[model samples]
Target chain A: MPTHNRIDATKVGDVTVVTFTDKKILDEAGIQELGAELFSLIERDNRRSIVLNFDNVDFLSSAALGKLITLDRKVKQAQGRLKMCRIKPEILEVFQVTKLNKVFDIRDEQDEAIAAF
Target chain B: MTEQSDADVWRRVIDLPSERGSNREVTDDLLTQLKVFGWPPSDVFAVHLAVEEAIVNAIVHGNKLDPAKRVHVECEVSADRVLVSITDEGPGFDPARVPDCTAEERLEAPGGRGVMLMKSFMTRIEYNAKGNSVVLEKRRT
Candidate 1:
């Protein structure tokens, strides 16, 4: 069995800050759960901005990236925004390689990511 | 008759759905298992990426979203290395035909980085001729 990683979310002002504590996010089940959770947050709270804090995350898989992309599209469709912060170098490389850096607003710090809204 | 000695080998098998969403949980579990087996953070990350790539390919391309089909993942860990094998039920594709992610035109593509990440992180990678199976190994220092 794979590790059970934790994801925590809190509201800071009008933005929803989601923190991923999982070191690795791979496979389909985990991604689906995460996607559903994020979507519910957006739908229930009417939040216009999202700050995804990856401070404890060390790696992310393409499957995970796909979910993020889906969330990004949803956020944009709602005229809200999704921002990523504290991405590890390795994970950041994945974003760069996939050219998702251009698709989502990414920052090096949580404060910067939140302030971008 | 000689007695067989127990060696420090770790093994696990996981059933993966053909859907793309299950990839994250399996990968997280696998990485945690590796860490419990004493792999360093760097080695764990590398193996994790390689495994993700293989599983993604198996689900997205090999199985083609066939929910009835399943992907099998196996991992073997020794004192100094780890080996991961992923097998899919669908007919495999030619690994050679896969576009190089580093190529100029495809560099901007969002999905092609899986193979590149697997190659870059693992010590060795090989695909069976049927393309239904991929085996990856990472050596821990």
Candidate 2:
């Protein structure tokens, strides 16, 4: 996949770890870019395990959450697993409030997330 | 107009075209102004996210992304309070009709979570009678 400014992708064992470069992923443009990039990444990569690292991101809008949902769906369609790790408390609150916590496999650490895959 | 007391709140009202990019511009402007007014980083993030959700709702859901339509944004900032109102030009929907995204059946749904986040972060949230306009407020402790 082509390089993306909003996120960085790296490989750890069988997992493709995607990390957001921005601390705030609330902007519409950035959110759109992230969704497109992640979609492209999932399509191109044949890997079945994906770990989304939220360590750098501090706050994200509902739009960003929507993008994550989209990514989760794409991963599921690819017959792969998706896990989110290192989410801040405030950001986690959003996931909890939306009840996405139940739908997603979220972990307090990256190792745990990657291991789950 | 008469001179106002320092205690009086200052307000800025902006007219925005129903464009996606305007969300970033408005969010940056409001965060910058709030930071200068001595709001902490966390509070700034709360207001920023709340406003982004409101604006996106207005432009995308409310205005249906019609360039011909417009969104009116009003921001009132006082020493200890921040009030923002966003109005869109589309036909309104019933707020109660919005499904509960937190429910198990709706968890994976792609939409309908914006209002939940807005209500979670802001101190108070109110929708106008027409349901096309939403007001969000945060009062500093």
Candidate 1 local lDDT, B7-109, one digit each (tens): 6776777777888766666566667667767888777877877886788788888898899999888777766888889999988877788898666675434
DockQ per candidate? 0.29, 0.70
DockQ measured for candidate 2: 0.70
Residue A98 in candidate 1, Cα distance off native in Å: 2.8
Off by over 4 Å in 1: A1-8, A21-24, A41-44, A56-59, B1-38, B59-76, B99-113
Candidate 1: tens digits of C-alpha lDDT, residues A40-116: 76676676799999987866787678778778878888999999999988788777766678777899998888788
Best by lDDT: 2
lDDT value, residue A80 of candidate 1: 90
Give one digit per residue, the lDDT tens place, for model 2 in A3-107: 888888898987889999999886677888889888877787676788989999988877788888988998899888999999988788888878888888999
Native-to-model Cα distance after best TM-score fit, residue B3 in candidate 2, in Å: 15
Interface RMSD, candidate 1? Answer: 3.6
lDDT of 2 at B90: 89
Please, what is the whole-model Cα lDDT of each candidate in the order they appear? 0.77, 0.84
Worst 10-residue lDDT window, candidate 1 chain B: B1-10
